[model samples]
Target: MINRPETRDLLAEARQVLLDSLVPELGGERKYEALMIANAMGMAIREQEQQEAGEPESTDVMLSRFLAGHALPEESEQGEQTLARALRERVVDGSDRELRAVLRAMTETRLKVNNPGYLK
Candidate 1:
């Protein structure tokens, strides 16, 4: 296990510095770019916090379910790339209700991590 002042803490501190110090001094495009960078850092912090809290990423859970339901071989052999291809095929076919539900759940999960504001 890692020590204190973890990844999330570091990112949060960096984001705070960007917002508190750099952003005030910046102007126009530079300020906009800095804000965008800070926003991305905030997202990374959230993702790191979720992982630290033992929450699994939606894609991993969804892919595992897909592999099990289909009786596919171990993930080590088929890998995410193959599973992602299968998922893409299902999405393109647009016929499986289960796949649609899984996709929706994944989308909501991602939104919660990357842009929770959109959920409100």
Candidate 2:
């Protein structure tokens, strides 16, 4: 299980940690950064969806199925899933420049979130 701090007021703080310490070093280059950003955005979206669902199960089996891949899928009809969409998008429209932009944007937005202290 993830040892997320209990004091966090929002998931945005978690995103900051990811941006500062995780995204930059991923894949030995920036190639994984866009995928990470898309994944984060997807997670944020999922949180909202769950809140709307009212007592939605935490273990989303459908998402688990998408995650169980050598690489993520290419937009499954089951849903507008992010990991799969990211994988597909990367396959189709990925470059170092584009990936860098994504990583930078994610990191910046994460840093700008309404969280306590420095985004470190």
Q: Pick the candidate with the highest TM-score.
A: 1
- What tens digits encode model 2's per-residue C-alpha lDDT throughout 4-115? 6533235556666667777766775464765567456546654554446542332344344434442444344532255446657564245445444444444444443322
Model 2 has a clash total of 0
Model 2 weakest 10-residue run by lDDT: 55-64
Top model by lDDT, which number? 1
Angstrom error of the Cα, residue 97, model 2: value is 43
Distance (Å) between predicted and true CA of 93, model 2? Answer: 37
**Tens digit of lDDT per residue, candidate 1, span 13-74?**
99999999999999999999999999999888877777776555556677668667876555
Model 2 root-mean-square deviation: 14.9
Model 2 lDDT, residue 111, Cα: 45
Q: What is the C-alpha lDDT of each candidate?
A: 0.75, 0.49
Estimate the TM-score of every prediction: 0.71, 0.24
TM-score, model 2 to reference = 0.24
Worst 10 residues of 1 by lDDT: 90-99
- Candidate 2 ranges beyond 4 A from true positions: 1-10, 28-34, 45-120
